[model samples]
Target: MARLPSGTAIELYESLDSTSLEAKRRAERGVAEPRWIVALAQTAGYGRRGRQWEQSIGDFAGTLLFAPEGASDNLGQLSFIVALALAQSLDEYLHEDQIRLKWPNDVMLNGAKCAGILLENLGQYLAIGIGVNLVNAPKGLAYPTTRLLDFIKDVPTPDSFCARLDHHFWALYRIWRQAGFGEIKERWLERAIGIGTEITVRLPNETLSGIFEGLDDSGALILRSDLGKRMITAGEVFFGPQP
Candidate 1:
């Protein structure tokens, strides 16, 4: 029950295939900007790169739809903004330093992925989907996974965490809109993992191995390989010695 921006609309559902899909539907129907869609259970949830996202009964599955306005040029930066906000909310229940934000938008807790974020562009609008494993984290994933309840005895419900996330999201969003990515980049790097380490980035058609340099001004990952410096805009990253 936290305060949202003016003209913001909220839609709650007990179940949905995916909140991001619902938000896209609303955008197609010409719903106004700044709408939030939340679902207690998602039957067909998904994450970035079209990977399946498992939604526990009480986990948080929500999407925020908003007009790009003048931000279309640098819209991709919002993923980092959202990640920072989500990390801040989780920091309330978990140790702030324990939370690490992976490149792009994955939130890692104690080296395991605890949450994921997806951004979908819907023409006139954009939908940002957020999934947090509050009570349960699915097992047998490619990478290590974790749940909030594993560390915190008194875990926060989906809605309560969403409220806190909403507050932090808007606060960071406002700063991004006014001050630009300079501050956001600085803040994100503060919590970033694998800054100067050997890593591999799996692209759609090719794989790149390099030293994880850092992030470029536009948020692209800077990879320093024997060939030279390369800026990666999209790819899956793996830290440590590549297999």
Candidate 2:
């Protein structure tokens, strides 16, 4: 509809170094139309903080190259939008309550991680990279992990999932553009995990222990720790004392 951004298209590849990398390449070459750069598998995929993200065949590996006209400053909010949209898309195949959104950019199914999102801000372009465990999940991760086939009787293929994800993403994108982040914060909190509970936040220099209060208007975390309530714009979170 007119609510969604124009000039957006999907470019599917058999394999790539990384969809996000491809988006950056396209941007470098001045290919400016918004697009979904997707790969069946990635050779050099990455997660938050440049950790290697291994992609197995049959999983969802894609990046959305979105050009936000007036959103260069408030780009952090897009992660919550992506999380909400991802949860909504996956909810179609399972009970809605089974899907939960983690702060920043992770999707939980049955209380285990099933998907993660990585955002890259490139001037006017934002490359939203996402990986979902469709058929199987990797082992030996610090936290628990899950997959779609674990719950769905018939899991959707990557291409099929892409269509659904695109549909839901645009829906939220419309709401965000029209109604603003108050509505987004409300919706995200409805499906959010660990609100009003104790959690750990891992920063680059140090870690902080706090109670997960909620998100502020700017999408930064509001943690209530011994140091009192403070806003944390960037950090990794844990639900319990680990380490």
After TM-score superposition, what is the CA distance of residue 66 in candidate 2 from its true location, in Å?
Answer: 2.2
Worst 10 residues of 2 by lDDT: 1-10
As a whole number from 0 to 100, the lDDT of residue 195 in candidate 2 is 95
List, residue by residue over 1-243, the lDDT tens digit for candidate 2: 112233458888899999999999988776546688889989999999998887788899999987875567787888998998899899889889999998888999999999999999977678899999998798999889999998877988887788888888888888889888899999999999999888999899999988899989999999998789989999989997667
TM-score of 1: 0.96
RMSD of candidate 1 to the true fold?
1.7
> How many pairs of residues in model 1 come into backbone collision?
0
lDDT tens digits by residue: candidate 1, 1-243: 333454356677899999988887888888745867889998888888788999988888999898865558698999999999999999898789899999978999999999998998888898999999988989998899999999988988776677788889888988988899999999999999989988899998999999988899999999998999999998898998776
Candidate 1 off by > 4 Å: 1-7
Displacement of residue 68 (Cα, Å) in model 2 is 0.9
CA deviation > 4 Å runs, candidate 2 = 1-7
Clashes of each: 0, 0
Clashing residue pairs for model 2: none
